[model samples]
Target: MSRRSLLSRAIRSNGEPIKITIDKSGANTSAINDYNDDAGADIEIRQNKYLNNIIGQDHRPIKQLCKATLGFGRFRTARITIGDFESMRIIRKR
Candidate 1:
């Protein structure tokens, strides 16, 4: 689960992003810089905590629920479970 591998996997799955907003983590900044240099992609990185708050807030419930379960056995299972949880949350909101 190195940062580069994670970033590459995300890009591979979701396609390249035009910009990315992240916290002020040097490792993440370095990884993005390296990725841009190696791949010749210009993906802007913004390190503002305020911009990331919405994402953090939205995941709080999922994190709480998963924390109780001690995590899923596989990535697919986690993805599916979280997807279901998010769907239900959205439905409840409407």
Candidate 2:
């Protein structure tokens, strides 16, 4: 494949569920650099902290879309169809 076609395919979104795994045990401690400095620390993954970070990152855009749908009639009146995975497929005829 050409470089341009390869890049275009890579950039396309294939709508997939993201999975995250966290180990509560300290067995898999990953080292993270505190700063650009050489100093580093090993930290275990905490479920609550991971969940909070995931929620913070993922929920904002969804909430904004919902808000826009409510605020704008054009967005609100979209023809919404529920697909196989319960994913909403919206089509705007306008």
Candidate 3:
């Protein structure tokens, strides 16, 4: 009998691009405070406890771990978190 592995992965996301800045002597401290409040390091740690899981040290598309067969209807997927993918900014790709 063949065996399959079921791996579980967890991801935490806050939708936004991270901005970096230098703390040089600025002319405006208020602006700096605002920017700092709105920005910081965007770090994500996916924990996978199963083999072939997306969160393992070596990973694949987390979305692939999820299986869904869409048929006879339009499929709308949101915030696909299983992969190391870019943001869906909803801008024109063409």
The C-alpha TM-scores of every prediction are 0.74, 0.24, 0.15
- For model 1, what is the C-alpha lDDT against the true structure? 0.93
lDDT, candidate 2, 51-94, per-residue tens: 76776775465456656655435533443411211243223312
Which residue window of length 10 is worst by lDDT in model 3?
Answer: 2-11
Off by over 4 Å in 1: 67-80
lDDT of 1 by residue, 23-69 (tens): 99999999999999999999999999988898789779978988988
Residue 87, candidate 1: alpha-carbon lDDT? 92
RMSD in Å for all candidates: 2.7, 14.4, 18.8
lDDT for model 2 = 0.38
Q: Which has the higher lDDT value, candidate number 1 or candidate number 3?
A: 1
> Which candidate leads the pack in lDDT?
1
Candidate 1, residue 92: Cα displacement in angstroms equals 3.0
Q: Which candidate is the best by TM-score?
A: 1
Q: Choose 2 or 3, whichever is better by TM-score.
A: 2
Locate the minimum summed-lDDT window of 10 residues in model 2: 28-37
True-structure lDDT of candidate 3: 0.31
lDDT of 1 at 26: 95
